[model samples]
Target: MKLPVLVLCLVATAAAAPLALAQTPIDPLDARDVRRLDKMEQVVRELRAIVFQGRDIGKPVVVQPAETDYQLQEVSRRLADLEQTITRMTGDLENANRQAELAKRDAEALRTENRSLSDRIASLESRALAETVAPPGGLGGASSGLSANDLFSEARQALTSGDYAAAESGFREYVDAYGDSSKAAEARYWLGKALTARGAHADAAGSYIAAIRGWPSTSWAPDAVVELSRSLIALKKPADACQTLAEFAKRYPKASTTVKTRAAQARNQAKCAA
Candidate 1:
């Protein structure tokens, strides 16, 4: 009876083991999860040791949470994204700076080109003015057997007679032949008047500038400056016109009433400030 009872008990135990395994099935864990569980178990063991060891041992134990590691990884990823964004912004800023520098260089180049063009135009006008007044046979033929005074007098008479063409020709000839003469400045002034009458304001300005180079105290000096300002105004150079007028009082304080009146008129036309 005892042997049969033992056998029945062993069979009952075997049947209960299968039923328990079937009722509570074990979920399969991957390698990563198994490692995480191992690490957590190790941390728990360390914490248990620290708690059991008592405060008098003075040993410190650090426990890190699995969630804290995930948070650190997320923060690291965000930091990497921010670094990439900053690098892109830095590249954009550098590109903008390069474009600005290029634009500055372009503007400077344009200004230089404009100045060169202006100089070329002025030179061409001067050459044209010389060609217009110079005779085909040159100064030798037109000014032949004529004294400097005679040529100067003829040019003045031609101007008075409203013969601008003849006056311009005669004056240009006189200037070329007797540039060192005392009447050269006067000739330049008359040449400017002829050019102004011909609507060559740019050329007229040039001649006026030459005439007043020394700021001579001659009777015509004040008038020449006034005429220069007028020519500058016609050439659409109000700033230069205003500057010329500003110097009038200093250069010709004792100028005649007529010349002063003309200077004032030029200033008004140029819209110069007081």
Candidate 2:
């Protein structure tokens, strides 16, 4: 009977232990509160990422008013300098263009005048050929004749070759040796040309006068008359130049452009004197 009672007491103790475990209490708010704490921790971590990105990784730049104003002032100053330099360059270019135009006009006028003079010389040369006379001497001073033509040709050769002393001597010999020959007129005229080349304007004027008077019927007379006036002008004798030019015009009304050019030059001297 005591053994049966001990077995029954063990069974009863085992069953009571299972029932107490099943009846233990559970907290309903504990799971919800834990979930809420986890959500709060996630939100804090997201906020830290946004703050770090904005402050440490890629922050917006703030401009200072003073720096902005200084940059604007520098740009304005540079623009002003550029404008002034452009204006000065424009003025210089305009001046250069004006000068170029003036030079072009002068060159054109000279060309026209040269063409006219060339035509006139061609006509005069044709007329002179018809009335030309042979010099007493040939090209050389071989014989006793020794005319002005030989000496003049030699002088021209010398002058062309830049031998001034020989040219002067030859021209002087021409005037002395053949004063009465028709070729003497040409010699005397060329002597004046040679003298002028040697910078002896006073002597040149005298020789030109002698040439004109020596051969009034020859073609060289009109040219000599004009040349004498030009020589006088070169000598700064404007009064004499005017008188000689007046005589030339009276003597040769239908003179060539070369003669007219000398007359015009004489008038220029007279005007300068005035």
Candidate 3:
């Protein structure tokens, strides 16, 4: 009778074992989420099956053995961790999408801005080029066909070919003949460059200063300012050089590389000893 009662108790325990090892359901809408949960569910089912099998192998066994309980708890804890990981991944994907959208918008805005700037620059260049070829509306109208560009090209070619004398002569002629020309400012700037190349620092400083003062809005003004500062330093007038360099940096902060480099050199030379 005692053996039969013990067997009955074991049978009842075995029957209730499967009920104790139940799986938690996961509701996922999207295909990606469905696949992810399917894999997780498979793992959970495997854990449940193993724990239930262990209970059947032992008489009057608990739903999960002590050793099996530890593993099941670990699996549950891992599932919770995976859920948190998925949440974080979803957040990161959302942020990346937002960043990509912002980048696309910013790129479009930059392209529009660049196109506008190019149009403005082209207009200025066209005006400058036209002014270069056109003669002054004065007594010099008869000789209007003679363009400053021709003279400048000749001067530049001569200078580059090491003909300092001819370059100097040509530059002087351009400045005198085209006093009111758009290229006048550039002509004066190049005159200073030519004089400087010929080791005439005093004349170069004068020419550069005149060029910048006469046409502050011209494209050559910034270059003239840089050249003047360098010439002032060479003339041993560091105080004046400092003033010129500081002015150049302040006025043309976004100037050409050559201008910026010269301005830096002038600042170094101008600053006094400690």
lDDT of 1 by residue, 64-180 (tens): 455978889999999999999999999999999999999999999978865764464355346545544444422231349888888888888888888877777778888878889
Model 2 lDDT tens row, 1-274: 0223443455455447557757986455587898996775565555444444555756643423448788899999999999999999999999999999999999999788656644543443344334333334323443445545566778788878877667766766665566667677677677677778788777676667656652386777887777777776776767666656665666788888877886777778666333
Relative to the unseen true structure, what is the C-alpha lDDT of residue 183 in candidate 1, on a scale of 0 to 100? 90
- Superposed Cα RMSD, model 2: 23.7
Full-model lDDT for every candidate: 0.77, 0.66, 0.68
lDDT of 3 by residue, 109-203 (tens): 97886566445434433443343332233212125455667777887787888887677777777777777887777776887788889888877
Candidate 2: TM-score? Answer: 0.43
Best by lDDT: 1
Residue 127 lDDT (model 1): 55
Q: Where does the lowest 10-residue lDDT sum fall in candidate 1?
A: 134-143
For each predicted model, how many residue pairs clash, with residues at least 3 apart or on different chains? 0, 0, 0
Best-to-worst order by TM-score is 1, 3, 2
Best by TM-score: 1
Report RMSD (Å) for each prediction in the order shown: 12.9, 23.7, 15.2
Residue pair clashes in candidate 3:
none
